[model samples]
Target chain A: MRPALLFPLLGLTVALLFAGSLLTGPAAIGLGDSLAALFRGEGEAVVLVMREIRLPRALLGLMVGAALGASGAAMQGLLRNPLAEPGLIGTSAAAALGAVIALQTGLAAAFPPALPLLALAGAVVSVLAILGLAGPRGGSLTLILAGIAISALAAAFTALVLSLSPNPFAASEIVFWMMGSLADRSMLHVWIALPAMLAGALLLAGTGRGLDALTLGEDAAATLGLPVARLRLAVVLGVAALVGAATAVAGAVGFVGLVVPHLLRRAVGARPARLVPAAALGGAAVVLAADIAVRLIAPDRDLKLGVLTALVGAPFFLHLILKSRGERP
Target chain B: MTLLALDRLSVTRAGRPVLEGATLTIGAGEVVGLIGPNGAGKTTLLRAALGLIPAKGHASLAALPPARRARAAAFLPQQRDIAWPMPVAAVVALGRVAHAGSAGPADRAAVERALAAMGLADLAARPATELSGGEQARVLIARVLAQEAPLILADEPVAGLDPAQQIATMQVFAAHAAAGGAVLASLHDLGLAARHCTRLVMMQAGRIVADGPPAAVLTGAHLARVFGIRAQLSEGPDGPLFQTLGLL
Candidate 1:
């Protein structure tokens, strides 16, 4: 892509983000107050909201979005399938199940932590299971089938928990969370997932060349001296970590991971490596916009994050499916 | 040194036998054409040479076991789909995956040379999946060339190419042999085979019925027997010639 066009377009989206996060809410804190509180030099109620609560939430949204975006791109690339999205593979569903189980068992409360870790572990396990079921030499269909299996298994398990729940709110809350949300998230959630997601993202970044080779097909990739099986392993683990961490904290936020990467393929000149960064920025933008929309549109109802994304994303997803179908095989 | 050697090889897929007790050998710097009737196990043979399919056989490439044959021989399957809009250069680079630990300067040069040889230098930036059938065939061949292995096993390399592309692809295979590399390509074009191949192995059912220079193997009766097409064989200045008369 022309650097001039690409940079500014991406820069502008990121730039607009500052306003979406800051300008919303009844307080209506502007750039000045947000920046001041961001510096930790300001001492006021406005500063407190901007600095402590809102800032972390916004940063966390950025991290979650970036994680989803990068992991999604990597999954599509490694699988060599455009329809490949991290959420579709049941990583998020499995992670959400882990978080629910942790909470229900009270182990997470007793440990005062390990909830995100457990969630991440659950996601990785599901991914591995999918990989195993798909077989080492399996291509797009194999991965897709494996992913559906994981999603079904995880969703079923989560449903089982909800059915067994004594609290009426637990099932609905699980539903809302599975639908995805970023409301009432704390700095603690940020600290839990950010570092690990970031690490996985960087690992994915290093795999751009490998992913490029994968476009030719696995047999071709293997002939290039690349360990095709090993690449599959790395990509699966990366998806689990990033999506698991994000879902564990933010609930199973749908479509951002899927749509962000699809759009970024065009944004970053259609290169897989280029799509990674673009997807990251685009993911952050999409999530933050959805988050703000959720908050502003139904302040009383406190619309779930997942619900907002699905409402906005469902039509777009359908359009994409139709568009892809019309094109060549 | 021998580039590929298969002994007492048998291939079965889904409880059906494709090849049973098939034996073959290709020496370094030789271009061998595998000519077979439909269901004669041409693809199965090529695949077995690369160990892509499980077979009960003793296959060796450069004294290495069958499992590591990819490091010694490059394989190009008959049906190829890139699945993504990949750059041609990236597609070709997949040929070097077996050399992961030590990708030296030679690997890069081979990639460039392969692209240039296949006349894909200009199309390197384009998406591979978008290319036409002939272009994809060339690009895939370039990928195998980049593998830089001594033995090249290609299935139906000219299946979909125009006459010109068929000639050009044959020239590339000829060039590989000239450069002291081994090549084994399954071909239906008997004329091209007679012209370029150092040896020809003709198959009927799942076994080799004839193996020798093109002159001896592609006899008129042999074509009629295997292909169910009557033809006349005559010697030319260049090589053995076949003129198909009609369906048997």
Candidate 2:
């Protein structure tokens, strides 16, 4: 328990932010009242809004952020590249398409909490496609290409579904999903995203040592008693589960995985164990900050998280590419 | 732990045979040097022993399957560039990951000893990406040593070192072997291999051409045939040595 990496720090931060997330909203809620409503269970309307709506939303975001961050760290460490990001290969996009499919087809309205599961299934499909097409080069660029291919296919399928649909509601919902947002999301959305994200977080963190071994190189990692195939499968499933669930709810929030993990690599010194947790905290911080910005900056406009992150991430990506190219020749 | 036993191993990489068939054994307290011309499979043979590459053969380390085969066999690959900026201590600690869950008090002591063994105690705080190539070599060797494993495999480990650094690096491997930890190192320099290693395994093209003591395996004729060059062999106070006379 080094003081810098002290578990207390995590507990304190999570608790403080968890309360902050509940307290701060458009409804002019205060900490004492929220706490009283949460415990006493007397202020029914206030309690429902606080407990049922805001609390679940905050918890879902926390879990999703943690999942994306952990998986992103594991992915980068596995590929041994700083520029590698989780969804660059298509998990998030596929998840979005999956959610879109469920919503546009009326399955989500028919079966609550199944949209994220649909997203999960789509994520698995895209991950499988990437692995099959990539041919085990296992580098960042190859994974990115595989992701792009899978994403394009999934996107086309989603667009086709929307175009063929007769309902205007379905088409508008598809457009909302395409842009990506977490607005007016309900309890069902929270339930759909939380479990998958939590499971994915555990699976990804369990591979922290394996990811560290992978930094030695794939061949070396296998030789070091890390079950490479099992780990790979776990990474794919776990990332699919997390990203799929998150995208189902949040609608394709890009580069929180990439940006948060990259930033924390420097903070935690790039050891996977330290990096994973640090990235988790960093991702939560980034998403929370972004969510707060979305609320404050454009209350009426409904700013999409995907758009904001991409706007931020694209420039960072260009900066990275330039830096990498500069270093090479 | 035994160094390694590779019984009739063959490897195919990308549908082409890299090592057709090779059988080799390394024993404890022995420094074995593997040398050959380009495409010689010197690296392949060592990799096979360590189970880095899949091979059609029986490769056994001390503790067999179900348990990890090569956990005791630490390796340093030919060409490695650190992708992330890792601190020296953390990189060295990676050696302990295999043993971390099961480590006794002894393992921790060994890690510290390995750090001191390679003279990296001072540079532990420094970032690995910042170190000089020669220093990086020492740090990597320190990592393998920290594994506290019985056998160490290094592929072309001293390729870029100056003569002094090369000799200094050889001494570290020599010290590991002297401490009853076996070493199977792939090398290019005939002189360094002959001087430091107890035995030599020579490959021409994916096959072992000669396997014997340095004096026998590194004869002028073998050097000329395998490397296609002339070389002078000498008996020094230390041991048999070689000096390469430009290409034949």
Candidate 3:
């Protein structure tokens, strides 16, 4: 597909999904009335539900999904591995660990900013560790192996923190947070995550040309006149910032990044630079659609968004592995 | 004009010298072949001179900023793996990345000319990773050609190519030199090197042992001492003919 058509189509899908998400919920509100309540504030009760309840949820879904998608594409490009994702590479898990620490210790309750801040710190550390373990010239196997180790370590720490939590309520809250959902998120949460997400998006935006050069390999990329070290730094920080903020606000939504980029790769002609923005928009569409599905499938039960994404993504990942294995052998 | 100049360049890795005190200069309208044994540091020297690794002494191209250096020189590493399934045209277009603005007509024309040069115009829209090994090698060579830089540094460029393709690729580099560009390519194929390269530099154990015309550099003494082999060298209708007889 031509880029001119693909981007607009993706943008349209996200927009339609955004509208669908706004209309989806337990309270049955007509589309026109909801739009009026959201934009015009004509009705009190519907407006409250539209502006306060659904608006923030849809907005968070868009932001979280876009972050995951962009970061995943960047990570894959940086490591030259299609299987690389923030969730798979321990970045999201590390961020979750930090968020859990904040919640279990009541740091987040006392100081709300501590949550995303510590999560960002954890994300930065894990990304640095992964890059160190899997050097720039590392192959896919080494990269995935390092990611497995880091992910396992982060998960172990998270489990330990949960097991040792002194307050039973805090433990349950942390458990719910780990399930990854956009339910009950307010505009305040959106505001808190906005700065970091914007910063991350901006940083990732510039990495397209660098990532394109890197498709040839490290030495080749460097000789192409790319500052490979600086590009690596930007990718690491950008991915960390995006994952930290997304995990802080929405828990650990897995697979959006991986699945979105994979699906859109061919459409973008598999160019890493073009894949970034396409994946961003595609991610938003997937997340919004998933959020809408959660409401439709188990509206009263409050099914988590991560559960749905993993259900779809894990099988896709398996298919990818099988396909790649066939190609290799 | 001197396109690339290295002044006593040296590289040390893990407290051992991988490339030692090599001084050379490549001028426009020249194709210089770098020939050596497996561990004789031809790759290390090319990498160090391109500033892909740290080294003592000076590589004139390495001193410039990244953008300027990229515009001045293009490198094709021995590992010719394409990470993504990008189209061949898109991969070739990556060569234009160092240029400041978005791609323009000149960039498109360069890519077109490169594809034609590598005889890959028909495969421009094909996925690069789906091509065979030799085809992929040509695609990568086309990518380097698309850069339109003054100098190209290629490592073992003809290793996987068939004899005909190897000669054709050499002719491409020769054409680049004829158009006032330069190339410094590492090769194990002494025949190809002798025929295609205007000059030859032979290295032994991290040091350049010979640097001159093919006849002068690939002498019996240099071949025996550096490569541990005896080779026959004679003139042919096309160019210099080189053949390896037996190990010394």
Off by over 4 Å in 2: A1-11, A109-114, A128-146, A163-169, A312-329, B13-16, B100-105
Position A228, candidate 2: lDDT: 70
Model 3, B1-248: lDDT tens per residue? 99999999999999999889999999999999999999999999999988888899999987888889999999999999799999999999988887777399999999999999999999999999999999999999999999989999999998889888998999999999999999999999998899899999999889999999999999999999988999999998978899999997
**If ranked by DockQ, best first, what sequence of candidates would result?**
3, 2, 1
lDDT on C-alpha atoms for all candidate structures = 0.78, 0.76, 0.90
**A1-329, model 1: which lDDT tens digit per residue?**
66458767876886688467755665667767767776765858877777667776787778888888888888888877777788767788889888778766666668745666678778878877877888776766777778888889988888788889887765565566566676666678888897778767767867766786676666555544456777777777777778888988887787787788887675454567667777888888888888788778987787887788878888998998888788855
True contacts kept of each: 0.34, 0.47, 0.90
What lDDT is reached at residue A254 by model 1? 78
Ranking under TM-score, best-scoring first?
A: 3, 2, 1
Most accurate candidate by lDDT: 3
- What tens digits encode model 2's per-residue C-alpha lDDT throughout A59-171? 76676677767668777776676656677668887887888888987998898566777887888788788788765445446766777888888888887888898999889
If scored against the real structure, what TM-score would every candidate get?
0.86, 0.91, 0.95
How high a TM-score does candidate 1 get? 0.86
* Candidate 2 lDDT tens digits, B66-136: 12554677778876656667888777777777674735666667667877877788988887877888888
lDDT of 2 at A264: 63
What residue pairs are clashing in model 3?
A: none
